[model samples]
Target: MTYCKVCSLGSDHPGIVVDEQRVCNVCRLDMVGDLLVNYRYTQEVFERFQHAGRNELGPYDCLFMYSGGKDSTYMLDKFTTEYGKRVLAWTFDVPFESTHAAENIRLAKERIPATFVVDADDDNIKKMMREVFNRPAPRKPGKYLDEKLPCVSCRTFFVIRAILHAHRNRIPYIALCADPQQILTMESNVREIVRGFYTTFGVGLTDELFRGEIEGLLFAEDDELPEIVFPFIAMRHTYDPDAIVAELKAKGLYASSPMETHCTLFPLLNYYSFTHWDCMFYKLNASSHVRAVKRNGGDGARSTFSLKFPGTLDVLEVEGRLKKVTLRIAKGEGTPQEHEAELVAAFRDLGTTETAARFVARSFLDMPAVAADMGIRLS
Candidate 1:
């Protein structure tokens, strides 16, 4: 039930091993080794290599994964306006997006000197998401994450596509706005599992695919594989959502974008630990928002946050509602069928057919037992 003191990763997470001082096993984040390939890469080394490399590689040759949020939005701003990079901003416009998110993407495209692509693979993506959500959760598998998080799956899909895109375009770099918490959250086990996952596709995500391999990218693009660079990592930037918003507005770029909310398969993994069992861990076990804040420049007050359904229109709002229904089911109580219309509406807004939404709602509520029943056999 204890969360990591250094990062948002909960103690119940498969990747963590708590020590005497209550430090979870990923270096207790002493050197940020839990996140970065080499925990030792300083801002100076990052800067020196990037400067020399940029001199040779020139600008305008990187492909960015843009999601019209504070981090990705500001990332686009930096890539086009500051660096003058000819960024091919790729968006995985799945059905779970807010309407305003789509509009934000357009505004970004209109403003930035970059080619914006909307990979509206909603059918396949939703299919994949449905599969993930419908699957049973397992015990915290050591170094093994449940494959039911649609967020992870979708991002993985985009990463593979980005690799292919960069390869086809002969672009030397693949850029993403990975905050510090994301860096830290990429525990060794998760990285190892992901390394194995992408190897099947014949893609190398970075030179040091495993943690502590060494500091290798960003001085220049490595030819053995296209470099995936985290800008904040190179600059050692802290997580500052407020600052990002302020900066974006100063340039008249963004009006507003929905803040992070769990309207997707996030609940399958996050809420699984909570609603199904008597454990203290639940929807906020490994918080993305908290971790993202820590990743940039700010510290997270984990005790201060709770996951909630932002509104009826938030695409993933069904997740929050279904989770409540699931808890009731676990307690053998009747569900709030009166709210079914609103529940279905939440899903339909995200492009899920009403029938599918109803079916999915039932499935989510039914699957927690599967997760709760998982036998813990630690290695």
Candidate 2:
């Protein structure tokens, strides 16, 4: 089976039957277009979204998932400075987040005067990362062969913690600082399929490695205490990146330069341009992107999936437009020579060339067609 050439919906093979139209069952429902239209709202709808979450008696008006990245900083700035809402900035400081991001969050705390919370246990995060990245395939497993993408796992960990925190604190609003593009790209149906695959991995991996931490999060109480809102969904149409960054910088909200290194594993694996992660991490998370790739309608390329498990990316299956690497080479965006230079530079930062090559190739060449469409822009 193959994807719908027009929309990039994938062929589900034995899992889902595609119709004569070559569109997957999911796409046939037209949910993707519906998702886009419903989420792209007018100013009146935006005001209603904000007003629905208004609470005067709540301890904090909102629990903001603050990545210390630009989007969350912008949201935090507005919540405190303009909107006059008492907000708490929460961070799940994954091990791989740049020190620059750390600096930005630190500065945000001082400038916004918002209470900040961070869950930064390096040892535990590293150990969990080892499970997904270095599973028991010493018989010589491929670089990303745990069959579980690590980047999405990190984001899931953050999300679970935030939900738990909100319930515990009775926060009336839970806000995610994702821009419209990020929110728009998120496919509702694809998430359920991907979650099914990961939940299985979590059960086994957590039993062996985390003992209870992972499962505890999965089973955490889900009492509804707050309404979740994506402020950027409304703001993206008019938000100016430069202006936002400028105001944030002037107010001492971010301490790092915009040009910083980003090799967040999932972004590296999902995008042709690993470097673009710095500019777009908050738009979407790796797990959802991978889910889209495994499902159909992922941009304009045919999506392929793993056979052993239903809804997971099959890394070995790289036929479609994986050759777009050649197109990128023709355009001078990057070449073999430049890749070697990047490898050499990466070695200066204590990473090995083999490790870098494996990841970069996965990021750049494996799913070239989808990568190009998703704004990594190989050509």
Candidate 3:
């Protein structure tokens, strides 16, 4: 006697049903479904420069957000070597970033001496990581769709840093490695981008979380601001993943770490998103079905294989994640929701707050030191 919640039907829908829930087939459209139906951008409009020569190149024109990951490396190749832009590649190193991430940066440097700007405070990162895990909260809806869910924080930091760096360094534009699908989800317009700066981290999030680590970073109006570009958006549909990976490797531009592992924080975040399944670390197995589930929610953490990891989930790791969740919930940072008891218990037992607080304080202190090292003036 189940009735559809979306369309209010009884057992007669034409499409494959979901979760045996009474949700109507019409209303069951996930984010990807909506994207395909409503937001698919025309490729031609974005590919205006596809056939152009090196004539468009400008001095100190754009900044590329490089993470030394596969996608980013390919984007760098497309822009600098192919498009012939005077590009400055900027890398922001966050807390809990793996050693492999650092190595990848080194590899990117060998291929192209891009301007690498790293903002890393291990103690601060560890602390925030702890807080993020301790809390019980619902993340932004868009987070689940991102290739790397934990990137919400890291991405915000880089964008803010990039905008500020671009302003101070006189770089006229910022080039994102994000594809069309990603940017569209974040809102493609410049106005949306500015608003996103606030919304993405959850409304009213202060720079003081990291102790005013981002005091001077703010967006300027279009009339007063520099340009920000996304050269990859147009190529999202046309680019072949295999071809790009091969090309980068041939150029000796492969990331220094294992090709499959890019962002280290992914495993932790994925654990919660796919809670029914095993932790992200376990899902990293070559045969693991994480990627498939990510593309389509089928078998989406429903299988027993996904359930096995919780038993082995480390107390500290759970604490760290819960702490982060608590902070986001407390701050009303990204998304909104009710607090969960299990998450609170984990955080309370781990002494993560003390750790995270110390990290925040340290990060605040490190800002001036980093600015001095980079020879950038702080107001």
Question: lDDT for every model?
Answer: 0.50, 0.49, 0.47
Task: Give the TM-score (vs. native) of candidate 3.
Answer: 0.55
Tens-digit per-residue lDDT, 121-209, candidate 1: 55545544444444455455434233324445666655655655555556666676655545433322223434544442233332223
Candidate 3: C-alpha lDDT: 0.47
Error of 3 at 226 (Å): 4.1
Cα lDDT tens digits, model 2, 1-379, are 3554323333432223356777555445444665556465333344654665545556687788988777788788888888777788888877566566778877777778788888665665566655544333222222211222455565555565565576667775667765554555332221232354356366665455443433443443443434456776655546555566677778777654333313344333433211211111221222233445545544413211100112333222322223233334435567666544443333222222354434544443333443343333332
Model 3 / residue 21 / CA error / Å: 9.3
What's the CA error at residue 145 for candidate 2, in Å? 17
Candidate 1 lowest-lDDT run of ten: 303-312
Q: lDDT score of model 1?
A: 0.50
Itemize residue pairs with steric clashes in candidate 2: 8-297, 9-296, 9-297, 10-296, 182-283
Which digits, one per residue and each the tens of the lDDT, describe model 3 over residues 135-191?
A: 454433223333233455556545766666766666666666664445544433444
Candidate 1: residue pairs that collide: 35-183, 49-219, 60-86, 180-295, 181-295, 238-296, 238-297, 239-296, 239-297, 263-316
* Strongest candidate by TM-score: 1
User: Model 2, stretches more than 4 Å misplaced?
Assistant: 1-31, 37-49, 52-58, 135-148, 187-225, 255-379
Task: Give TM-scores for every candidate, taking all chains together and pairing residue i with residue i.
Answer: 0.60, 0.55, 0.55
